[model samples]
Target: MPVTHTYNEEHYCKSKRERRNHRMKVGFIGTGSMGGLLIDAFLSSGGLLAGDVIASNRSPQKLARLAQLHPGITLAESNGETASRSDILFLCVKPMEFKTLTDEIAHCLRSEQIVVSITSPVQIYHLESVLPSKIAKIIPSITHSVYSGTSLCVLGSRLEADDRTQLLKLMSHIGTPVEIYEHHTRISSDFSSCGPAFLSYFIERWIEAAVEATGIDHTLAGKLAGEMLLGTGKLLTEGEFTPQQLQDRVAVPGGITAEALNHLRCSLDGVFERLIATTHKKYDEDVAKLDSLFGRDGITRRK
Candidate 1:
């Protein structure tokens, strides 16, 4: 079915030449947290100008919020308009919305236009079946907001060498893009994407303990823990110190650090075992659901 669209002509990039003239036209179908962060990072990368970007969201409140932040950006009137007007379209909606959103706007996409899915459940084959375009899938982290975060990219069948090169060139400014097979995208995503939040939560608990143990304020304790983590990260990246060597450098035998480390370390074997098993099992189940959604029968419900 042909999708109906409404757009302000001044905001839409209509032609191939226009999309390619200086910077590529970038369209965002959803302007929620992840979408907004990515738009910020991409603009910071200098690969795109504010005028080259187009955005649309179902929620008026989100549109209002995004407008306050990016006053010069073009807000499309509808999803179909956003899909039809850009060289690269980023679908940043939630996982549950992917199938329905794609089904709605896929017909509006041009064959040469590239559709990139940031949501995990939206697989490449599903996109290929729905849209007449090249597809790229990425799992984004909140860290990308910092412009130094790592992201994983698993390309669809249609994206060629030049497409990959252009995409990587634009993506590299935001973070390191490690290309991997589609199957690996999920677990690697779990690590690089979820690691920051998970580790932050872990750090928060330690910070609370530090505050209680020393009577320091939570803010000061947090700063202390954060600075140590920053330095530790630098050390680990700068040198080839093995985990044992790093531990030894800090915790002497019979010392307070070692005493605590020994206790935590003993518990970690089972803790981490459960963490691994649970994470993998959940991701595997999600992938299986995606398979069912995109299976030959096309019988699956999106949500």
Candidate 2:
């Protein structure tokens, strides 16, 4: 089945040569939800022609659907074919599949090809040791799909300047990409990658309370809570106020807001503190385990 697409012809034509000059032939191994999102962001960013991107997955059916949706993409039969066809490859597989997949495609990857892994805890050195290509590790959040998330990318010391620039440009469309040390990547994941989930938990609690107090429909309550959070996020970005400053601004002296804030601080401190500490501890433990199993070098595990 042919996929239908509408694009700016003039824009594509003018940019075609420029894109060909600088754009990479990209391949994605694993067309799952996250992989699909990456492809979407890349295409939407333009410059790279549709034919420049290829993808391969374990399930041909999944690839077929993706190819149908994006007619410009070539579907590879195997992981090695995907790696060989592209200048840059993204390993979007699960942590358990990392070693096996890398082993399968190692021989196909060229020394100049750049491989970016989104798998948690699997460090860049593990990838470099297994594959001959230059490697990078990125801790990306689910918000990448929305094109407004944060990604903490740790570039391996072995990567060339051109490859690093290409990576930053490719990922910039999805969100703000921050470069950090390898060890800091794991810590960033604890806050930035998993931060969305933590925020969602609080929003869920807020919605539940709103539903109970106002007798609003559960769905409406959820929407309201989400919008509130969205607005708060925008305010935080636009205003120069720190989090503490924002909190102080909301709590008026001798008022309901102040009373509520006091109650929250007094009653919720122990519970929230314990939850945050436990989450960080668990994240560190997972990183330690990956380092033990994979052997760390450029990719330092957080312990």
Candidate 3:
């Protein structure tokens, strides 16, 4: 028996047309290093057109450079105007500036628009108090410019399903979008968003030691270490090999790798423990400081 299938050409054509003409308005309130990187990544991802991006920064010099880099990006007259013109707004200012920036643009934020906090310490409460609706947070990485990073997102209370889907679609083109709880935002941000710099710092230290110990050129030592780390990253991400498994694989019972591993274990006993603990504690303290400023109401600043 032959089954006859009906082709809905009109529906298919309409979908194609929508995809061809779709565009979203994006706004950035700060245009610093992280802020500027995001704009470039977003535009390059083709999620949003450069002309639809509205950028505003405190520094005219930075704005001038950004405009030179991407002339299509709209330079808004004010933060409020940027918020007013955007369907999705990103606050890239410092955490301390969150309250002030929110106060500045709150009146301009439409009820239907989404305001995302790209900085830490500012929570949903702080954003909701003034913006009243669609308050969300994201911790995106500088590595997003390379299209390989983790973007930790915490959705707002009123965000629509369609909106979340659209956001994921736009962001995932640049990096992996992972939803995280606000309580774990600090740890997650530290591990993914802030991990690159921390890793690079250690790599530099290792490279210096390798050059000194082996009498190899610093350039060659650094390149070797970098390639090893890059391959390890791929194996961890693409292969089934766990960090512990890979370590044990190289650290055979009494091999040279084992000796090196043993020294690392002894040397790093409480160093990483305290370092990580301090990171979490610092984040909590900063959040507490911001909370004190906003009080329970999250609007009134501390005198």
Top model number, TM-score: 3
Q: Is candidate 1 or candidate 2 better by TM-score?
A: 1
What lDDT tens digits, residue by residue, belong to model 1 across residues 119-170? 7656777788778889999777887777766778988889989889977877
Question: On residues 1-303, what C-alpha lDDT tens digit does candidate 3 reach at each position?
Answer: 121212232432235457457566789999998899899898888767888899888878898898998878899888877877677888999888887887677766656677889876788777776675487888899889989879998887789898799778878988999998888888888888888889999999988888789888998888888899879988888977999999988889988999989999999999878877988898878888878766776264321
Model 2 residue 208 CA deviation (Å) reads: 1.8
lDDT tens readout by residue for model 2, 41-98 = 7777663568889899998888999888789788887787788767788899887678
Model 2: how far residue 297 lies from native, Å: 11
* Reference-based TM-score of each model: 0.87, 0.84, 0.89
Off by over 4 Å in 1: 1-22, 240-244, 298-303
TM-score of 2: 0.84
How good is model 1 by TM-score? 0.87
Please give the lDDT score at residue 246 for candidate 1: 94
Off by over 4 Å in 2: 1-22, 270-273, 280-303
- Write down the lDDT of every candidate, Cα atoms only: 0.79, 0.76, 0.80
